[model samples]
Target: MTVSKKRTISDESRVFQEKWSHNYFFIQVKEKAICLICQESIAVMKEYNLKRHYSTKHAAKYDMIEEKLRIDKLALLMKNIQGLYLSLKTGHKDSEASIKASYIIAQKIVAKSKPFTDGEFIKECMEVSFEILCPAQKQIFSKLSLSGVTIARRIEELGTNIESTLKERISKFIFYSLALDESTDLSDTIQLAIFVRGVDSNFNITEELAALFPMKGTTKSCNIFNALKSTFNRFDIKLNNLSGVITDRAPSMIGKNEGLIALIKKEMGTCGALQLIQYHCIIHQENLCGKSVGFQTIMKDVVKIVNFVRSRALNHREFKNFRSEIDAEQGDLIYFTDVR
Candidate 1:
């Protein structure tokens, strides 16, 4: 027995015919057959469906019109629909451009470490620039949303995307190092910053801030080690890949018996024969040395000597000439006291 297959909607040729527009006063607007009288759309493109809709709903009002009048009406409706479709198409493109611009502006603001409210200032600048260069684009520019809240949302979305990409790359790390620092915020809350520098099998190195953990309670060596272990677990990477640790070298970090580095070494030793390098931050070490040695006292004497030489016009000119003769850097002693 032969079973016949039913024809699917895809099998039918449903293109709108030209005669239907003139006879039924129907025209295709964005693929749907629309009646000129009521501006109602017929979902099915078949002549039968279009005819039935016109006869049932609008035939009484428009049936009395002459042939010339019907043709005129059809032409006017087609013109109006074309204009509306054109405007809608332009609006769609402008909307997409506005969204892209918003993201770009948001990213720039964040990269510059500016506040979210700066987006409003940026929008104002954009508006002024547009007005000066091309006033016709004011309407399109207005579609962009650069409010403070919108900027914040865009920045958060960007951060999430970057984090997602980093997670994907983390799984491929052949070796990695960590850098840690702790500081107190404006609210007096301690923030432990963890940064990762990882190398993949292809030897591509990626370095980024992994996380910032808040420590409202104790910030002991054990606390730091536990937090680090939690971070490693979250990333789902092997402990064997931890090749190095860089730290600010506080007593809690470098203590011989119970430091964070000592704890990590013990953990890695049990896993296997591993070589983990412990590094102290050079800049931090320098800062500590300067503070301990009273760098301010030394700088005070130097500043006094500079003032003695440059305070008088004669001494300043002689010093300048002497420096030029020696090919020294071009600068007078101008110290910014705020810098440490």
Candidate 2:
């Protein structure tokens, strides 16, 4: 009977040689041989294994280089690896530019009342345009993150920045007037929008959207007052600096008792030297006047014409098709909102 002998390989033979880097473009990494070009790892440091990997994978191109040309090729590969690392270091700078671009696009999207998901589609169209117009810019556009989530975050950031800047401007105001309006959105939520017109000590006048509060419940006079107070507190606005309040003829806005204007006056007290001026919104008055009996005669005819095209499904579709045939910018007549 004879005992079978098992072959054993020592750690020294497993150690990678320095020459392998120049010979087969493989480097010693944690005791394993790693290919420079493909980054594939060789388990054993045997020359035959490295040679087989190089010959089968990269030898067709790299093997053609000899002497100084081989050395230069090796140097170029090393430089490429270094370049990859350097790109990561400069990625932060590129990210700032990308963020600015994203905010500009987000502003336009918000202004146009576009859904957040449109950002992705816009990016795809922009990339295609870039590919056709300037292929060199494709890499730059690829860096932008215009996904819906990213766009939402970017818009939120822009809003916060604007709010902060507006607050800073408000703090410097010598006098300011507020214009308030309330409307229900498609979701039936009451939205209260407030605008501020302010003049600083330097007489620099600034007008901006001060607040847009959502009233989940009833939008009563007291509720409107509370919302205004919250906005004032948030912006650190002083009550005495208020010059005027502007609003439509809504009872909740201009009521004598417990109205938003009355509530503000009550807070300011009766003994103030300068009286708080109340201004009815001229635009709102004009809109109300436009619906008066005198204007109704003309508007009725306009409404009839609009309804002729919009009242029926077939009429609407045919009108749209006709408009398209004529290359009309407006697809159909706009139905009058307050027409009776």
Output the TM-score of candidate 2: 0.61
lDDT string for model 1 (41-146, tens) is 8887898998898888878887887688978887887888778879999988889999999999999999999999999988888889999999998777777899
Candidate 2, residue 175: Cα displacement in angstroms equals 0.4
Candidate 2 runs further than 4 Å off? 1-93, 270-273, 296-340
Model 1 bad stretches (over 4 Å): 10-15, 27-43, 64-69, 104-149, 270-273, 291-340
Q: The CA-based lDDT of model 2 is what?
A: 0.87
Error of 2 at 145 (Å): 0.6
Query: Which predicted model would earn the best TM-score?
Result: 1
- Residue 151, candidate 2: C-alpha displacement in angstroms: 0.3
- What tens digits encode model 2's per-residue C-alpha lDDT throughout 150-260? 989989999999999999999999999999999899999999999999999999999998898999999899898889889989999888888899999888888899788
lDDT, residue 33, candidate 2: 78
Q: Of the candidates shown, which would achieve the greatest lDDT relative to the real structure?
A: 2
Tell me the TM-score of each prediction against the true structure: 0.76, 0.61
Model 1 residue pairs with clashes: none
Q: What local lDDT score does residue 105 receive in model 2, on the 0 to 100 scale? A: 94
